[model samples]
Target: MTQTLTLTWTTVCLLDRLEPDRGVAALVDGVQIALFRTADGLFAIDNRDPVSGAYVLSRGIVGSRDGVPTLASPLHKQVYDLRSGHCLDLPGVAVARHEARCRNGLVEVRLRQEG
Candidate 1:
């Protein structure tokens, strides 16, 4: 059986606005989200760094580690898996991951609805 994820996709920006292997910050559903377009694909995660508590993940470096796309925190260099939001530098710490993609020249991100 195929599994389906229930999510609301919101268009944040145009694909042309983003450069490859770079991150851009966007606000979706009142939450700060960092969007990245790497050689692998587009990925979205919480903008705030779990360690420093600063909203600056958008400035993080993008690279691949062990075949996983990752974003390293600019403030303290805490690396996080872009696909799973798992912190590499420090175990047991992680940022929230989101679904982000480019469609029809536009960037769209998934937002989790509040109860």
Candidate 2:
């Protein structure tokens, strides 16, 4: 059986307002999410840096590693995959990644549910 999941998308800002290769912070349902606009596409992840306990992921440097979009934490410079939120520098550590899309020039974000 296939289960259907409903996602509530929150409109964050205008797509034109976001510059390419940069990140912005938004609060959805009391959770802080970091939204990134890269040449590849839009990506969302938790704003809190797991290494330094700092809510500064939005300020991370945006770049690519081996053709994969990545964000390096501003505090500790730990690179994280924007698509999977996996820490490339650390083993078995990851950040929460969310769904982000552009609809009618608006940037919307959907929080990913964790099991």
Report the number of the highest-lDDT candidate: 2
Distance (Å) between predicted and true CA of 115, model 1? 7.1
Worst 10 residues of 1 by lDDT: 1-10
Off by over 4 Å in 1: 1-7, 113-115
Residue-level lDDT tens digits of model 1 in 1-115: 5544547899999998999888899999899999998888999999999999999999999998999999989998989999989998888999988888788999999964324
TM-score of each prediction: 0.89, 0.93
lDDT of 2 by residue, 1-115 (tens): 5543436999999999999988899999888999999999999999999988889999999999999999999998999999999999999989989999999999999888664
Q: Return the clash pairs for model 2, or none.
A: none
